[model samples]
Target: QVTLLQTVVGAHDLFDVTVQLQPGGGIFQTFVRGSGDDFSVVVPDVTRVNKYGRSADCTSNNEIRPLCYCKSNLMPTSSPSSASKSTK
Candidate 1:
């Protein structure tokens, strides 16, 4: 099974996210900003990486190069209070 091993948040105002995959060897990274929307990344044979807004999905792939699926929802501003609540 694939798992999210590590993640790093960016310093800039822009949302920069990086995720490390486990069980195999794959890395997924992305940046998000502006209106709320979804974005997808298709690697097409290695593995599928799904990124939602500032969140990232990194998973290992058994195949040579699988398709990556990334979805994101951008917002005008990020609310720290709301984020904290979700963590709990």
Candidate 2:
């Protein structure tokens, strides 16, 4: 099953979306924009690395790094309020 992961609307009404296939699937990233009255995939489907447990696989050179959600990002972070509530 293919799931729509993320969608970003850019200038000129362009839609940048990332779709992920279920069951050990790769990330398919593409861009869509309006063609007259109908919308279409303007760009080709680019398969990005599965950065689930291996965020290290994505480097600075990777153009899709900005669009990826690293597993580390899902980790809970200490909120400002929690950090401020320290023992006296």
Candidate 3:
């Protein structure tokens, strides 16, 4: 089973993320700009439920599950290294 080890919310128009895992040895990174009121969660290594961000839309009946929601409106950067650290 995969476990959610941590969550880091973005700030200052920057949503740079880096996730490190052990035993599973997984590493994921993604960057999202804070413009347009967008939010996203990215898990780089695998293409499972744990990799994508979920929305808070209650109408879809998906909100009851922790991983069901809207797709991010923000654009992803070409590289995680180019992402700026949020100041908040």
In candidate 3, clashing pairs total 2
Q: Which stretches of candidate 3 lie above 4 Å from their native place?
A: 1-11, 35-38, 41-88
Candidate 2 residue runs with Cα over 4 Å from true position: 1-10, 35-37, 51-88
lDDT of each: 0.41, 0.60, 0.42
Pick the lDDT winner. Answer: 2
- Residue-wise lDDT of candidate 1 within 1-88, one digit each (tens)? 3234232255333444445554233465555433347533322223246422223234344242333332322224659998899899
Question: What's the count of clashing pairs in each model shown?
Answer: 16, 0, 2
Tens-digit lDDT track of model 3 for 12-87: 6555554554422344455544456675544333322343333334345643433333333233545554554443
Which residue segments of model 1 deviate by more than 4 Å?
1-13, 34-88
How much lDDT does candidate 3 score? 0.42
Steric clash pairs (candidate 3)? 55-69, 55-70
